[model samples]
Target: MPWKESTTMEQKIEFICEWRTGNHTITELCRSFEISRPTAYKIIARFEEEGYEGLRELSRKPRGTHPNATDEMVVGGILLLKEKHKLWGAKKIHKLLYNDFSEEKIPTVLTVHNILKKHGLVSPQKRLRRVKPIHPIFDPKLCNEVWSADYKGKFLMGNKIYCHPLTIADSKSRFVFTAKGHYKENLASAKAEFTKVFRKYGIPQQIHTDNGSPFGSVAAIQRFTRLSYWFIELGIMPVYSDPSHPEQNGRHERMHRDLKAACAKPSAHDLKAQQRRLNSFVKEYNHVRPHEALEMQTPASVHEFSTRPFPEKIVRFDYDSELKVLKVTRNGSVRWGSYNWVYVSASLQGKHIGALEMGNGIWRIFYRNVFLGFLATIYHLGQAKLRSNLI
Candidate 1:
């Protein structure tokens, strides 16, 4: 049976020719034919290739390649490159193939990577070391799932005044959230500024942060300081890197390097002027700078602010209904729901405790409106106690 269609390709071609013969401009012809410039050019090419018949629809596959170029040969070449240059990425592999072999036989970089992966020649890149698995992994499956956050550290302007940049990014989309200066690197300042971002962008499921006091603490990898505590209160999990492990949070670290190279190094007389210049660079970074991870697309093309609104009041979870019992004491310790809970401060006694259930033997202990910390079941406690007493 002939292929059934709503509109015939021949008819579309005839329309294009008629419009052109009537002295319609290329743009006007394209508009009248409901086609793009490239599509119009394709139709014209078809008309020349095999006359009107060719204009109907030819096979998209390229023709006249050597029959000897088998799939196995292409796979073998890709595997050889992977073995020889274990460090080279897909683009570099493609370049090597183009430089070494004829262009007609060479495949795309994506195809090369696919072949390498199929042969188990390489492993996927490891995730950030210090981050928890739940901290919004940003594989860029489509775009804009995660955004990196950090301060660029402090540097002097031409006038010798210091400027500290607080940066945020979309991890999956590679969209730059913000790249503006803060008066200082303190928690209050960082919180005040980042609040604006949370308000504008809505809350990300998780925000990856370095082991800085403002974003995190030295005691625990996922512990929240005052600013990060605010994030937790807002339903955003705070992720932290191990101490002295800057590379664990490599994305933000890398961005800082690029930001410094692009904006901070070329210092102006004051922070205001330097910031003005930095703003321009940020605009370029988001709208023009080609990202290799994004397949050379600008970050803006793959990013948009989330529609979820940032609630002015922090969301409160009620444990009274979930737990069989509820308790509060002036000493910030709670004995309720058949469990004993200890909190950091003694001042929170007599206030209500909210318990958020985290699965797999974990529970978050909260006092009044503040989240005290998490708790995990100690299954071998009786055995350890017996051993200790025996000792």
Candidate 2:
């Protein structure tokens, strides 16, 4: 028959007590209990040293060695350090402890935070209350499929005028498309500058920007204001960030911060001088600076220009094969097979409209030469038909 097992520490202590009081010799007890001599001796020694109390489990840590191990005090000090210095993550805190308390064994960051929680010394992290989570809609499998563009705000030069810089970066390679601009922040000026860039680097599939008035407008999320409208006319999709969330467009935002830190100095003054400074910095940023997110690779090293060439004359499609409709007014409102509907602009009016067969229940609307946009069949069929016989 199998022997009964000792479940609790007290039962084990009683068994040890029986052996130590001469019920059995140490070596014989070790054989019966299937324990080593050292284990048997440890139990015997513990019982002798503190009577029955020692037989119970006690912390193996030495007493009075760490004079400053109070949980509340340690957590308090960490909070103080975090508040005093702008730096306060685990790695930073570890470095601080190493510098300040060389003789003490600093606890891990997890341990420090646990202590803080126990004493309620730390507050919960502040999070944006009403912001929607942004997921990256397009991850370019190839370099240069998409590029992000924006003006890195403006800075005053020594001449007291502001320099508005327009920056463009490849979404995949993080290669800078361009980083030069003057005080001119208008759409026409931006278009001219981007035209030059497109000529050199070729056209990208899409370009992303914030909803700033220069790039787009809050009133119309899909309608291209001016800079974006031109791109759409040229076959490039314009992507816009969510309103009020700068980090949704993180790459451009990060670059702007770095540019401000590097270029905004005491001596810089007018727009021209600032442009010169920006040119120099762009060279360094593209070729020299290592990006942590890119595995320390310089942006230029990984970036490749797109293969699509910029055509001198914008290409126009014909409505020969499909159903055609003439938009009668400049309001972008149009008359289709049996339905009257509004569209983006008159750029497609007076031009033949073509319907391209897409997936199940989907169709693309096009003008004499350009793709206007998409419309759902259910919604497109709901409009009243206009007849010539109705006067």
Candidate 3:
């Protein structure tokens, strides 16, 4: 019979009394109590050692320190580091511990976490709900294969000016190229910052960004903005994540999160001060911070400068002999069928485009080597339908 919770003490007393009477064997007592022989022996041993005091329920809590518990000195070191970098967690703290503590002396990451947790220094965070990688994410093997850039969401500074931080990082090594604070997200500011980065880091094969202004346009052909067109002119391709899906460019987004935490939470007084803070963040991120993806290696140690140098002057694009070439007018339209003007993007004004006639009144367009889209050349009521779905 299982012992009732209310009658547990009574049952223990009855078992002891029955044993004292010598009426029941150890097995019989265990059977009556629905407990093992070892439990009966333990109860009897405690009774023998301390009489009725032992029969009263003893504390279930552990009496002394565990054998595998972290040493007091090591706990002090962990707490000190946590005090220094309150934002950092156990993994980063564990890595830093090697500077002062030997590998044998240092505790595991979990142990360090428990040390922080025990002292109420760190709170348990809800586990992130993981989702499947539904969208295709491009992972570059080389440093300059792709670079990701974005404007970290605008935040107000102490001086009451809204600061827009533009951050660019190498896709493979996560090496931050630049993090510039701008007054606004405009073409001139973005172009100036990018020119500086391009001249220093050289040109990447491709640049990845979200569907945002100065980088891409929803209405334009192939989502090419003036900035992206410039990339095309430099023989660099521009790529983008799908609209409303930030996780497609998750690595860059993750960096933005860190940037906001480090610099934006306690915003600087002015743009100049904000720029200084960004510079510090870039230095620490590239050189000091150890990335888990890179096996805890710093980004600066892994990244290499691009081989393609930024040209002083952009070379003009030449088309093949078979295609008909025409320059886009100031109004961003081409002369079609001598009278009908097919409207392209105004951003493509003064640029030359080539049109190759495909079968069935369809004409395929191209800017340099990149295919713009398909255009139906049959002039119906002075209107030419442009089909940009091929992209």
Candidate 4:
């Protein structure tokens, strides 16, 4: 005789009434009620404690508030800060909360986000799916172990001139070295800005960049542009993200999102004014902003200057004694195996490279210490033809 689902309250009341008669034993009553002994005894205990009211349906709702519930005062602080900095997210707000409240009083980043979401203040953004990192070889363990540089997409200034922003940042510490504004993204402008960076911060061992003009060229040998060659001359290896894959340079890209929001929306009237804005952004980004990756510390607090200073004179590559060395011709061709001119790359013109014979007809090419590609000397119809396979 289990209690009917539709009339549980009536059945419970009837059982309590029947139990009070004392003629039926608790076990006998339990059998009659078709309920377990524990359940029967629980109902009996509730009736004794609270009388008829206890026999009525007990509230399934929880008692009082949860012990771990967030305080209304903290929620008020988060809402106030959100209204103050409309663009900022929970992490930044949480960091700012430290100014007014103790660490114990402040909510976590997730908690702040949840509060915002509950209040309908947070708009859900579509998550962009990312690809695997293209080059997993370079994992920078220290400051200046590597540095990333890229030209953010060009935008029109108030004076109608297109401003291209070239940004450079340390990979490990996330310190922005420079955010230079240029009329165009060309070799001269890029080189000048980099020279300033190198002189100030010292040169990094490796510089990471996207496969684009001034930094790289897919058509050129080993994707080396003239700027890249200059880097090699100064003992800095130039690395590139895979073509069309922006996630490989995700940290730098993330910084660009902030930069765009802060500076580019309502662009400054002129290049000089825009430059001032950029300078302000650099100062704020390095000193004021707290990075979650750096344990809520500013980049300036984490970054250290690179040890490799800019050299006064560029050092020439010293090749192994066994390998044959050849200088690239003015026309970008290297004379290989008697009269056959192998076109290496126009970018490599006037540069000396070494060739080590790997096997039968394939020769391994080297520009400085970097492996350029394969140089295969093929003979067809009694005529020897040199084919350059540039990586």
Each model's lDDT comes to 0.66, 0.68, 0.89, 0.87
Tens-digit per-residue lDDT, 55-94, candidate 2: 6767897877575564555556677766653223444454
For residues 158-261, write the lDDT of model 3, one tens digit per residue. 99999999989999999999999999999999999999999998999999999898888877899999898899998899999888887888899999999999
lDDT of 1 by residue, 248-359 (tens): 6666677677788777766777878887877877787787565677776668887877756688987765556663224546664555334444444333334455666668
TM-scores vs. true structure, each candidate? 0.53, 0.56, 0.86, 0.75
Ranking of candidates on lDDT, top first: 3, 4, 2, 1
* Pairs with backbone N, CA or C atoms under 3 Å apart (clashes), candidate 4: none
Residue 24 lDDT, candidate 4, scale 0-100: 95
After superposition, which runs of candidate 2 have C-alpha atoms over 4 Å from their true positions?
Answer: 1-133, 327-343, 346-391
Per-residue error at 305 for model 4, in Å?
1.3
Candidate rank order under TM-score: 3, 4, 2, 1
RMSD of 2: 13.0
Colliding pairs, model 1: 144-173, 146-171, 147-169, 147-170, 147-171, 329-349, 329-350, 330-349
